[model samples]
Target chain A: MRSWWRVLGVVLGVSVLFVGAWAEKLVVIGPWSGAEADPFVAVLDAFKAKTGIDYEYRTMRAEDLSKVLPAQFGAGMAPGDVIFMWGWWIAKFADHMADLSDVIADVPFAYVSPLVVDGRTVGVPYVVFVKPGFWYRKSFFAEHGLKPPTSWPDFISLLKRIKAIPGIEDAAASGDGVGWPLSDTTEHFILAYGGVNTFLGLIDGTIKWESPEVRAVFENYLIPYLDYASEPIEWTSALDLWWEGKYGIYFMGNWITGMVDDPSDLGVFALPGAKAVTGGPDIFFVPKYSKNLEAAKKLAAFLMSKEGQELRAAGGGKLVVRADVSPTAYPPAERALMKALEGFTLVSDMDDTIGGEWQAAFWDQLKLLWVKPGALDDVLRVLDEKFPKG
Target chain B: MRSSPRAEPRGKGEGKSRRGLPLLFWRSSRRREEWVAALGFLAIGLVLIGFFVIWPSIRTLWFSLFDAEGFAGVRNFARLFGDREIVDLVRFLRREPPWGALLHNLVWIVIHLPFTVGLGLILAVVFSKIRSWWVGIARGAIYLGIVTPLIVGGVIIRFLFDKHAGMAPQILGALGAPVPWSAGWTAYPETALLALVIGSIWLWTGFSMVLHSAGLSTIDRELYEAAQIDGASELAQFRYITLPLLRPVTLVVAAMTFLWELKIFDIVYVATMGGPGGASNVLALEMYFSAFRELDPYRASAIATLITLFSLPVGYWFARRRLRR
Candidate 1:
């Protein structure tokens, strides 16, 4: 009886040791809610099937992710082995992320080139969208004798011509009364003329805000639009303006193409400027305290897989990250975006929702300044103070 | 056995022998128990106070003193003071057209408070007069609004008020009125306020009504009968007796509503994000932008501290009054 008891105890101990040693669960954090969950869920399933490692997924808003991550890293709770984030957020969370330089050798050229943070690869690109392109009603544009303008001066001339039309209102300039489209258009124009590097330099105070080039872009491009937008913009009433064929031009993202899903009323075209190409990159990162690094790497690899790249195209978007995928992975609008990408500089947009020093200084303060009329000099001074010389 | 006569002397002798020590220990033990009870209560209270009130207050106070980097000192507060909008808001008062969103908050409170309280009171009165089953159903229906998540409510409200194809414009358009009710700031502030108020009232009126209904149940029906017999009209009876009787409840509800209105955020964020050029930016939203959204935690804390300071005195005074009564 004593020998039997000893054997039982030994067996129990061995089982316990085995269980403790081989406990594997991957913790993943990403924006995978509702419709966004499909691609991630499929990829996670594929990973599980391949590696036999189960994952715990936590979906959070991109904004909340930024706020929570700092504390999560600070408190050693960042159990995120893999993370899906917006393009601009990667820069803010660069310190806490692991180097992906080895991993990037396998990614596409487009993703590889732009997301190089401080000579270290911080994140990998997965999904890409551009916000400042001109999306116009094709039927209306055709009727009103409008074509996609390929230069800053031509774009203004087109706008002037459209505004001169007897009863047409300029595409919904409400922006919650901030009247923001003017600046967004102006920034793109500046980028087209001077390139992305020059534009970023201006924002960071390396290039002077008072320079003639910057002044010319604003005075020539932005002021005219603002003058046109002097009338009260009724956003709620302007909903059908795009669909009703009442408005000829709308400055927005290609994602607005979904609005034309009714088939008969859909038309989208790229904005043309001196720098005829414009778009922003999407970046994904791995959080510092991820419990399952290998599983995360596998998932990241899968996201950049051929099948995953096809999902991006299926969602009516672009996938420039996977080396296996062709440029044909982009839809019509995205194809134009791809074509335009060669000439115009890629805007180094940051997700302001991510908490950063640059966020408080440039994004939020600029938003407030854009809304209310305040001292431009003071605003510039504050921006310079925040981003001074380095 | 000489027991009866000598027993008294024996008892007396024992009492005399044990007098000082027994009395001293008995009194001391009771005192010690009382002290323990007092200390135990104090410890529990202290823990509650520390967790809920003291710690957050200290953290906020500490945060306000520093800049966004949260070093040690009054730089953030100094910067807030130095901000042009804040300066102009204080110096020029109403002379300034836009008052750094401070005026917007005041306007929100002024516009929404009366409507919320009045509607709540009416709902309470109606609910009280109804049968219990009807009251339950009505209560449930009202609570549905409250139970709906703020984001859901905000989203629905946004859609309901969408400009061209939204329910309002569609209804109006169907009625052959070409008016644009949900368009720009010039036309939409009133509509926006209405939407916000409608949502807030839907979620919160039930709470106030329930409080009022509870208050109503405690009222003496005999007093109402006497008033009615005395030829007092319903309005007069309500004004004179019910209003005075319900004042305590009114005070509680008003303060609660005020605080809730002061901290109004999620609905606005979900709806318009205080857009159309700061049309709906209440102080709470402004503070949030200052802190988390903008990463200006210092200014955010300062604004929160000011709100806390403003609320504390009133809260304490009311609490003390209620306790005394």
Candidate 2:
């Protein structure tokens, strides 16, 4: 009777130990929500099936992350073991993220360099998207005898011709308001016309925002159709306008192709300029306070692997950043984005380079400048107030 | 038994007879129990108020004095007023982003607040005379807009006035107005806040009506009857008796409505996003943007503190009136 009681105790303790070891969780957070989050969730599901690691993904938009992450971090709550974030958010969260250079050593320098802060790679690039991608209806371009423009002047001429096309009410479509839609267009234009140094200089404080070159880019490339273009609506509705065949060309990210009704009917290109392409990659990193750092690192390493990249592409129709990984498995639009990323001086989007408070100001103040063009100096002055000149 | 009787210092009759002073501050058995009972009743409520309200307000005020880097000073507040864009607003220059946004919020208060209260009062007055279940149903129907999520409602409003695919332009065309409905009211800065105001009115008038309904229930019917018997007109009865009696409720509701207007965030956020170039921004939404999007907690806290200070007078007035009651 005494030996039987001892055996029962041993069994109970073993079972508890097994459960404790296997049931530990790894949490992940990202900025994709609603339908955009659906495919990514599936990819995580695939990851769990392949490896016995258990992780939960929480969806947060950019604005929500700005508030929630700080609050969570301050309270010593681990918001995520692994955080899926846009590359631009690296600066804002660098202090809280784990240095991942050695973890992602197999990833190429080009993909890893953009996310470096204070000489440390803070995140691993997992996905990529090209910006200022000019999307037009394939048949619409054919019907109007318009070929993709290779020069800035040609692009403007094409826009004018599109306006002249009878029954085509909107010659070009740009989403309304003070955010990525407008700012991206301005950023790429500055990159394309003003060159890469002029673009980078905006972030480094060497280039004046009110310079003649910057003014010329807006005056020649943007302001001509400012009043003529559609009123500022959100991207979804603007994409809807393109889908309905009302707009000739849409200046947006390649992701717009995913939102369209017929992906096959669209053609895309980086806006014609001085050979500088504005784009960035989506990345993930382990936060400093993660309880399961080992598991998080394991998941990130797998994510940067070729098979994992393929699984993600299959899952989210995402553009992969790894040059080692082929784009053949991705959707035609994503494949096109991959092809476009080659042989170009890749510059991060306008919002990414000058992140934090200035980005918000740029977004809000751009609209004011849009309505009152004479207030450009005032807008510049407002930005200077936040980021003073050395 | 003899020893116990000798040990008794005061007789029961003596204890009850006369107190040298009021026992309020004295730690007598009965007074101590009363104190405990009062504290016991207040314990949970006090804790919740302290944790959720008073504590956060104090923390936010403290946060206002420092920048993101832990630089302790009033520079955030100074920079706030000194901000080129905000200074533009202070001067009412109207040519820039912050200027127009701040002015638009003022316009919202001028237009949305009065109309919401007026429409609510009108609905209450008209419905107050009815003697049917349908009146309650009607009030609920008007309030349906309020219950609809702001994001969903904003989307619907955007579609409603859409210049191209929306019905507004078609209806206008039918009326021979020939207006540009395809571009949407949200498309233009001049019309964006106006569109938001109309949406706010639709959303909030029912809230006012309900508040007015509650006030109407408290007014004595006999006062109105006496006024009518004294040859008062319907308008005269409302003006002299009903209006005077409903003043307390009116003050509370109007103050609340004003607060709502000042802090207008979701509707504009989901609808206009403070655009056609920052034309629809208000103090509250700007505060949120400053805190989260800007990551400048000092400025955000400053804005928050300012908003809280503005709410204090109205809050105090309401509290005083309720206490008087």
Candidate 3:
């Protein structure tokens, strides 16, 4: 009886050890799914190959992450070991996240600074998607004998010419959804007309939203063009319209390269005198409540490494945040945009950086401005009031 | 002979114990056990309601008092009224269509309620008189909208108003009407709210029809025959018999519809996202934006409380009318 009891105890102990090892796979939650998730999954597969650490990727909507993560963290649990989140959200929930300073030490401070909160590095910078400028079809522009604008006047002339095309309805398509696409286009106008200081100052709350420089950008550049603006359509739908030559140009992020039918047909250019381009990195972080904290940290560290960024970049639609990752790893369109970005001052996306109420208001007011240009004063006033000034 | 306890004619105080307690207090063991069993059944439902509904509502009301900075008393309420997104009286006075979220919801209720109720009655009356097999098919087809989920209805609304392939734009274009909504009806400020409201009427008219049809069946056929013997026309008979008889059902339908309109969110969320410059924004969507997007729970709670307050009166009126009947 004593001998049998010893054997049973040994078997139970071995089974426990084996089960623990089997459950070591990290759970990673991200916003991408389907074709959009393909590149990200490729990187994860490579990580799994190099290290025996497997992972389970859970797809979640980007917007739902902000709402879901807080509730999960409040319950002293988390949906996943690591989460890909917006930088502003990382700041908001910094207390619940694990400090990732050591993991992302080699990353540039410019990229790393936004994810820091209360002296704790809460997230590591991942890939960045740039709002390069208005993307036009190379074929459409060539067919219409239209050239990309070199100045503000030239841009207006281009719009007029495009509007005169047989099938075109508008000079530009206004993409919307919670009004962010219009906000992005409006930001481009601000950056081009008001200069980098005015643009950055407005974001940091140093320059008032109702300031003359800001108003001038709206009145001089945006309002006159409102007459030729397409009615606000869903961003993806707007892309389809632009592709079909119903609209001349669409101001969107570099991520459009992946969404379009063919990247080779896409052509992009910034506003004539624009000195800065707005974009942000997709930041990922480990939650403190994660049971597999060490393994999660290892996965996060690997993602930020050049090897992992290279794998992601080669798969297309994303630009690497790491300086060590080569531009050649990207597809031609992304590679060219990456090369061009070296000349421009990279500013973080305004509404994304200043999130919460201000971001919502910004998007809403931009939509209002699009439909009713006369309400510009009211829009600017509301924006200023909603701005989170300290 | 001693009377059995069950057959005993107990006077007001005859069943009382020495302390003057009622017979229920000193009831048989079986009666006490039955009471315990009844309470046990009720306890589960009471506990669930108290935990899920009552506690959360009370908590929301409490939270609404404070703002983002700290314990701001009545400050959030003041903001809720003053915020242009909630009620832009200035724009309304200027005769702008897309006034505010509150005003938009009112617009939805005003237009949607009457049309749905009136059309429902007309369809029910017309269908009742018909004896064709297609009548059942027609009724089923109409009620299908009611069975279909509102989320799916929202998608249907989107496509119905879409410029590219939608019937509305195409039909208008063919008629040589100037189609201003090049992007689609829901994508424009002037038409976003109206489009959703009109589309919603189609979705809800079916519900009203089904209810009214059921009510119509309960009316006496002899009443119409009596009116006809007195040389009453069809319209007169409808006015005297059908309208009066259907009053209770109409009250129920209208009140329920009113409450539904006040809290309408899913359709607006899926279709327009309260966009085209918040032109089609409604109260429930505002609450969601406040809590999730803005991350201001206080303002969200305030909006929630207001929705509940708006709903209470209609609900109260319905319950009171039903009780009176």
- Top TM-score model: 3
> What's the CA RMSD for each of the models?
6.8, 5.3, 4.7
Off by over 4 Å in 2: A1-25, A33-39, A109-121, A150-153, A176-178, A314-317, A337-343, A369-390, B1-19, B22-29, B66-79, B84-97, B100-105, B131-134, B149-182
Which lDDT tens digits does candidate 2 get at residues A186-225? 7877787788888888878787777787777767766765
Please write out the lDDT profile of model 3 over residues B1-325, one tens digit for every residue. 6544556556774554343344556676569899899989999998999999999999999999888788888888788889888999998888655587899999999999999999999999999989999999999888888888999999889888877767787787777766445447876677788889988998999989999999999999999999999999999989999999999899888998899899999899888888766789999999988998877799999999999989999988987887897
> What DockQ score does model 3 reach against the true complex?
0.47
Count backbone overlaps in model 2: 6
Candidate 2 chain B: worst 10 consecutive residues by lDDT? B16-25
User: How many Å off is the CA of A291 in candidate 3?
Assistant: 4.3
Top-down TM-score ranking: 3, 2, 1
B277 Cα displacement, candidate 3 (Å): 3.0
Q: Candidate 3: RMSD over Cα atoms?
A: 4.7
Question: lDDT for every model?
Answer: 0.61, 0.72, 0.85
- For model 1, residues A283-381, the per-residue Cα lDDT tens digits are 677765566666667677766667766656655533455556666765665565556455544554432222244443443333334333233444445
Query: Candidate 3 at B105: error in angstroms?
Result: 2.1
* TM-score of every candidate relative to the true structure: 0.76, 0.86, 0.89
Better of 1 and 2 by lDDT: 2
Q: Which stretches of model 3 miss by more than 4 angstroms?
A: A1-26, A49-56, A106-114, B1-34, B68-75, B176-183, B225-231, B320-325
Model 3 residue pairs with clashes: none
Which should have the higher lDDT, number 2 or number 3?
Answer: 3
Clash pairs (backbone) in predicted model 2: A176-A232, A176-A233, B163-B181, B163-B182, B163-B183, B164-B182
